[model samples]
Target chain A: MTYCVGLFLDDGLVMLADTRTNAGVDNISSFAKLQVFSTPGDRMIATMTAGSLAVSQAVMNLIQEGVQDPETGETATIYTVPSMFRAASLVGEAVRQVYRTHGKAMQEHGLSFDVSILLGGQLHGRTVRLFQIYSAGNFIEATGDTPFLQIGEHKYGKPILDRAVTSETNLIDGIKLALISMDSTLRSNLSVGLPMDLLVYRKDHLEGPSLRRITEDDEYFLMLRKRWSEAISEAHRQIPQPDWGF
Target chain B: MTYCVGLFLDDGLVMLADTRTNAGVDNISSFAKLQVFSTPGDRMIATMTAGSLAVSQAVMNLIQEGVQDPETGETATIYTVPSMFRAASLVGEAVRQVYRTHGKAMQEHGLSFDVSILLGGQLHGRTVRLFQIYSAGNFIEATGDTPFLQIGEHKYGKPILDRAVTSETNLIDGIKLALISMDSTLRSNLSVGLPMDLLVYRKDHLEGPSLRRITEDDEYFLMLRKRWSEAISEAHRQIPQPDWGF
Candidate 1:
């Protein structure tokens, strides 16, 4: 299982994903799940995927290779898409194409062709957008009322996002909340492990200095995890105890 | 869906369960999921269930009616059980019987005959035990190393237990942590709602004065919910921020 979260705030987008992948309990491994596509000053796109590693890799490859735009008769890739929505559509098409090519063989072996992607970014002149793309190649955009999207092992980390995130949140708070949420998931589930990938997209900056790979040695994350646990324990102690007789 | 947790401690047992039941989003209603049986100074057993309403109800009925023990050829029921183990066996046997009677018909209608129960308590001469009974009637006990068990919509509430619970935890602290865990589930899941039922069993006290039904008007719960949220936000503020330039 994987855990990926995308936050859409007024300032821009904050995306995070864990790198753990496993075929079974004994075959655990880590692989980068976050993908970045950017043509400086033109557009910047970030996608984090969860589900079948094969299918997600295939879709990413197809997107990188580009496809013919049905309307313009020209190949449209993540770089060349005129809008965030079209870039999302291009990703969706890539998914469908991969499914058409590999879905049947996977079913023959009783495996699912499951894959879900959190897509967030902007085109130079367009406003930033966030979308959750499903396995069927369809997608839904996040709205201000529900401005965050999560995929895979999501429930454990969701309450924090539900309570702390909002459209008006700045990129810094967004990243903090995302890390706290990820910390909660990592503590509860073995399927989701360490070595996380984080990216913060500033509103108008098309690129540079916005990505970090967090491993066991990352001092900030280590401190955040320790402090957050202490905070939760402190919070637990601060709650008023029920005055019941027995 | 339901959210129930059982904690086994050196001092006793603490069990908490939400009563909300739903066939779908529109068909939600409240039904008590926690059942308690006590034979004064002899023994006490509590069973909390999650899954198909019909299957659980039937299992409860069969346990109440009694069954012949295959090993001794004597009738066994929760009240007559010699130890906590036998009481759990009785509940497990009841589950198997209910499945034998209704499993196929439910499957024919494309529904699962699924039900899981958390049983916890003690007999006067025996140590306290907690068991999580599966749909097949097989069960696993909570040990000193892992002192808590949860069922149904469990993930959202698990991190707290993972971090805070242990065999040496006192009864009051156990109950507090259980409530905090349940509060987390209640906030994130619509399927698990208010009017929760909580039961605390002190070792060797076959007994009374330790159960309460919490409702929307419950003052302690309201305060805990408010304070916990604030504590989390405060903790968030106290964590060190990433020193990145973008």
Candidate 2:
């Protein structure tokens, strides 16, 4: 299990992912699931992955190596895609390609080909965008109405995002909400552990995203977690108990 | 899909369940998932179920009809259970009996045998107890360390319970937290819908559980939902935005 979230606010994008990965309870390990593809002042694409580590790594490697466009005979990679849409398509094609290669073998071995990705970034003049790519290689973009997308162990962290995030939200608030969301998931699930990767992309700031690797000892996150818990407890405590006269 | 939660507190037990039952998104209806078997001064047992409606209904029926002990040839029903532990065992046995009768047939029909139950109550002269019964006829009791159990669409509602509820929590607060948890699940999941059933049982007050059928128009629930959303938003807003020097 894993948890990765992306917020596409009017101001920019906030993408956060935990580093924990496990084949089973006993075989837990840490791996960086967030990858950044950037060419200063040109394009900055960030992707956070979740699911079977093998499949995710394979898809990432495929995207990095580039894939041939069947009709044009030209290889296009995440770094060279003309638009965010095409970049997403390239990622999807790479996923399909990986599926074509390993999906059958995995099935025979009783392993499901599971993987999902959150891709969010900007390309020079193009507007910032966020997308959630499914294991089927298809994807959906986040719109103004629903400006956030999450990949794994999503339910635990979703309520906060549902309540606190929106397109109109500023970039700073977006980042805060994303972290709060991640904190909720971390507290509720053991499979999603610490050492998180966070990226805050300012809309159209193609130079690059502000990145932070949040570890267990990260002071700000520690404070945020404590404060958020206290806040929630206090919030509920303030609500008068039901006076149903039992 | 359904959402049911049971919180065993020092003051008593709080059990809540949504009434929605769905075969598919298009085929949906409501049925009472929370059932109480009370013999007033003797015993009070409440069971809340989740998963396949058929399986749950079958298990409920078996418990109501009473299962005969194979060794003693004595019939044992929920109401006649000697202790809360025995009541839990009875519920588990009921689940297994239902499985023995329908599990294979459901498998042949390509349906997985799915059902989980939350049973909590007190018997005369016995301590209050809460147990979560699995489909395999196994169950685990809630202790002071973990005083709450949830079944079905549980993830969305679990974090709040984890953060707040405990055996030491008062009954009134337990009720509030349970409703808040249910409210969270309702907001996050479309399959779990309203008109909920809420039961509060004070420890040793075996004169049946105080019950309420919370409809959409229930004034207190409407107010709680509104206040909760506002409180969460306000709580998050009060947290200072991260100054990560983006």
Candidate 3:
């Protein structure tokens, strides 16, 4: 299980992914689920994946292999895709290809070919865009009305998104809210754990600043965790408990 | 889909259920997912159901139809259960009976014998207890360390429980917290909606004066819905988004 969220805000994009993957309670391991594709000033595409690690890794591998347009034999890779839209389409096409190749055999063994991809970033001259790509390889682009997308273990962290996330939100604020949402989920569920993979891209920068692994020693995250817990306890103390108890 | 939560606390028990049942987005109807069985001053058992409505309803109905114990010719029902633990077993047994009757046919129809239940309340001469009954008819009782069980669309309402609920919580506060949790789920999920059914039972007081249907128009519920939304926003505002966000 995993939790990956990408926020597309006016200032830029905030992408966060937990590294925990578990087949069962005992078979837990850490795997980096956040992938960054950058060509300096030309393009920057980030993908956070959840679900079958095999399917997602295959999909990512195939995506790196690029796609060829049937009309013209020219190949379009993430780095070469003409627009953010095409890059997203190329990513979706790669997922479709992987599904076509590996989906059937996996299903026979009672495995569902599950993989969801969050692709977000800028491509040179194009506007910053965000998309959630499904296992079927179909994808939907985020718009102003719905400016963020979450995949895997989403529910435990959704309330904050519903209340605070908006297209007009600043990217940094979006990051904070996303972290809090993730923090809430991490506290309630054991499947989502650190070290977290966080990437923040300022629109048009065409590169992510501060790509880092957030481990236990990370000061900001530790502070955020402690402060948030304290705040909740204080909030509970301040709020009047219901008068219904005998 | 439904969202129901049953909490066990020092004050007593708090059970809440949303009233939405849907076969699909288009085929939605309101069906109470909560069932109460009370013998006035002797016992009160509250059950919240989730998953395939047919399986749950069948399980619930079978529980309602008292069965003769093979060892003893006497029949037993929820109200007749000797303890909350026995009551939980009876509910689990009824679920197993439903599976025995309908599991194969549902599987043939490509549907799951998917049913889960949250049972909480007290029996005469016993302490308040809570149990989570799974589809397989196995159940786990809630201990003081973890005094709540949630079923159906549970994630959205879980944070509040994680923050405020304890074995010693007040019933009125428990009720309010449950409402706020329900309100969060209602906002985030179309499959889970109003009107919600809420029951507050005081320990050892089998005669409940606090069970009611909270519809869209009920004044107290309306006030709660509005106040909760306001409280969330106010809380969000008070939290510093992040130094980075600024």
Q: Which candidate wins on lDDT?
A: 2
Off by over 4 Å in 3: A236-246, B70-73, B234-246
Off by over 4 Å in 1: A69-74
lDDT of each: 0.88, 0.90, 0.82
Give lDDT for model 1: 0.88
lDDT of 3 by residue, A1-246 (tens): 899988888888889999999999999999989999888878888899999999888877866887775458778788788887887788888888777888899989999989899998887788989999988878998888988899999998898788778888876677777888888889888889988988888888865554767787877777777766666545544555444333
User: How should the candidates be ordered by TM-score, best one leading?
Assistant: 2, 1, 3
Model 2 lDDT on a 0 to 1 scale? 0.90
Angstrom error of the Cα, residue B22, model 1: value is: 1.1
List TM-score per model, in order: 0.97, 0.98, 0.93
Model 3 score (lDDT): 0.82
Chain B TM-score (each prediction, in order): 0.97, 0.97, 0.93
**Worst-scoring 10-residue span by lDDT in model 2 chain B:** B67-76
In model 1, how well does chain A match by TM-score? 0.96
Residue A171's lDDT in candidate 2: 83
Q: In model 3, state the lDDT of residue A205.
A: 83
DockQ each candidate and list the results.
0.75, 0.84, 0.47
